[model samples]
Target: MEVAGPSFLLLILLLLAPLSVHSTPPPYLSPAIFAADYDDMLESFRIFVYGARRTFKFKSEAESLFLASLLGSPFVTENPSEAHLFFVPFDGDLSERSVARVVRDIRADLPYWNRTLGADHFYASCDGIGFGSDRNLLELKKNSVQLSCFPGSGGRFVPHKDVALLPAGVAPAGEGEPRGLSSNETIEHLAYARLGAIKDPGLVHRLGGDPGLLIESEPSDRETFERRLAMSEFCLFDYGGDVSWIGDAMRFGCVPVVITDRPIQDLPLIDVLRWQEMAVFVGSGGGAEGVKRALRGMARERVERMRGSCVAASRHFAWNRPPQPLDAFHMVVYQLWLRRHTIRYARRDWS
Candidate 1:
């Protein structure tokens, strides 16, 4: 009458696995609720992220990890039948089991998915992570990724492994921008500055050509982008959402002047750079125009050094060096092709 059996345990594991899988999406990604074509593919990607996260109300740490994972996911899916370039988010309650299961699903799907999506179509933007100075990534022999995005991150905390250094002469040998000015350059009509609010209008009035060229009226534009990189020896980006723009300046080779009020006391990614070594910083108490005067007053050699440092600084961090927008698309699309053409064609696993 005493019984010993493994079948029941196996049944339970099988049932639980699929149920957990079923719990993850539609609601999490909420694609059905997506309202617009989002103008561009990038916009579509953003809207998808926005709408999906909107459904959750969680603590900041959860939000950060979620974002990192979301960006890190290797399974790239765009609706196959429609021209839709975005996929719905994985809708699920944020339990440990749920998260773990989803990660499993992604790992399983990626290689097969790549085979399905045309090799040229898209690729996962998932860059593997690594430790501070460890070759953890290299040990795995993961492919090297290109840092294709913007300001190139003006912040100081990027990890050492992530930084890419420019050789000498391409960037000056030290602590500010290099020695000579590109005399052929002319400060143009759009030359301008960016900051949250300018307490002192002195530099703003001086370098900022028209009263109309206000941060509020125009916000930051391509013109502001051109101006900051072109006219000044360097640029300063701090405060909310400055990460994106700071990245842009780095991509353009302009030195970044940075200071932050945010209590990001632990972002090792921003800590790798020597802040005062190449770029300038106005403490949190210092406002916009004041920071501007600091940049404007620096000597040409200092600017060149700063520029070199900016380039040197850019070598680190996934954010400072974003992959090309096209690369993600290529990853996603290629996976889809391989899945359709090879795996499904042979494995007959799923239609």
Candidate 2:
């Protein structure tokens, strides 16, 4: 099952064509194909976690927790030889030098690292990988799959080769349950910010004065934030190239109103879900007036339908104790599954 050398390079080049810089709108592979092979993923997929169990749980180390989860899961194999994918549990917060050292250690200790030149290996991170040393690990960057919180048209993220790690927690620690608003109680729109300034300077000033929206720089508490999210017909998500908050909007049953100039794939689960059903897109260049026009222009009935779909899509973002079916954990696993199956190549280059 291991493909190497020139054959592996050819397969990667061919498969990555659609994900190249100049690709069209519907760029990802059909989710239906993944759905059909879901059972095969559960039945045959094997992963080798390359380290000891992590005892310390840092909030930022999602990769650590993911490795722990897989260690206890059915997909993990005791033998590395049978593993379809190898997971290098590199902490996202590691210094560039630290990252390079870890990669060097893996290369020194493991025969598998050189077999396909890390083609079937993967690492997960809550923050996007942003270090030059990390990026300079040519084999890792070129061949390995990255499971990251941010997936955009950037050097760090390669579509089809990386999976978006949905940031968990519907509300912050000690927050109230995610409750839906009654049809009559919903606000026209809601926008909240716990941290970081709005990427667009004029956006907050333009939207802050509007009585139809529950817009605030920061909510008083988690209750207030969750309440506003629940009570909104639509939640504005001004993409700053970070996707940490969008899941909360969906979790509370408010359709997301994403303002991004980039492709839809910039958001999580773009490969699997039909985003138009649950989210509204406004061009970032359109400014606040454009967002207002788009939201106010939608039919009331269509808004309700999208809200319902948004709630359904939120379940995929949930990460359970042991990991559940179709939750964030399984979704990540399925992405790795896709990589495992798709890279298989058998033809000889006779020419």
Candidate 3:
């Protein structure tokens, strides 16, 4: 009788409990810059420019423009003491000494670096030409968010911590411009080889003589390239130095057929963008057969759906002058925002 009574009571208690769970609020991020003192609205957002001149001019113009765009955004804060994140705007050649000098100076001048061991700090670089060789830079890269054009796996690119920036050429289509979805091109496949040769011999051989595929040894000039891209239904992308052409393909309403053995680290807005919905990924082992299989598997309706998604996702990869919402610049910031959500910084006395 006692056991029966206890079981009855437990059943009643379980029945009365609420089933739904409430979601938590997003974390707040107030990013602060550790740059030189300047009077040009350094305290305000969207107008304040990071007061560092182009020291290492590798892709100086692109670097300069990106820095200006980020610094001019509302995410920046004047007071380091009240900030939740830190940014070190350093541009030039990716020299360990130059980066080290900036890091050392900032760490000495501010307590933020010591607070999180530079975990919350970030540096932006468009040039991936020379930063890989230095051991110190590699270690530094491990600790901070590295925004660059070459955000690949292995080496210093930690996907959760670093950002892969979209190249400058992938700008949004202007008004009256022909979006790629409506193209009437007869070609089914388009491949441009800027690197002279394909890494996979099997893929090279398979696509080399295919009548339906257009394999160009050299890229056409801008106008011709866009025209060819606009005409095709599927554009081929491999593990090249940069995957920026994916953006171009999407802009032209072509579904990208990514053939890579390694992970694609430089995909723009990956945390937010559902890449599988817009592009096709063929593994290295699959070779040309895999690519053809993927294309064959995609029914006309599914291909149309993917093309629609690609058209929708194109704007996220586009760069605007003032940085409109969801554009490339904002997308980078949004990536940083998402990164901020992953981290929980310990409260420290900035006073």
Task: Report lDDT (Cα) of residue 135, candidate 2.
Answer: 40
- Give TM per candidate: 0.35, 0.77, 0.72
What is the C-alpha lDDT profile of model 2 across 208-321, one tens digit per residue? 667776666677787777777777777776666345666777777677777878765646776677787778888977787888888889997777667666655566676666
**Lowest summed lDDT window (length 10), candidate 2:** 19-28
In candidate 1, what are the lDDT values of residues 183-245, reduced to their tens digit? 576533222346432334453454355442324324356655444454544554453333434
Model 1 misplaced stretches (Cα beyond 4 Å)? 1-183, 186-191, 195-224, 261-268, 288-293, 296-299, 315-351
The TM-score obtained by model 1 is 0.35
Give lDDT tens digits, candidate 3, residues 240-299. 544556677677667777777777766666666667777887787876767777777778
Q: Model 3 residue 290 lDDT?
A: 72
lDDT of 3 at 55: 41
Error of 3 at 266 (Å): 4.4
lDDT over C-alpha atoms for residue 106 of model 2: 85
- Candidate that scores best on TM-score: 2
Give me the overall lDDT of model 3. Answer: 0.58
Ranking by TM-score: 2, 3, 1
* Clash pairs detected, candidate 2: none
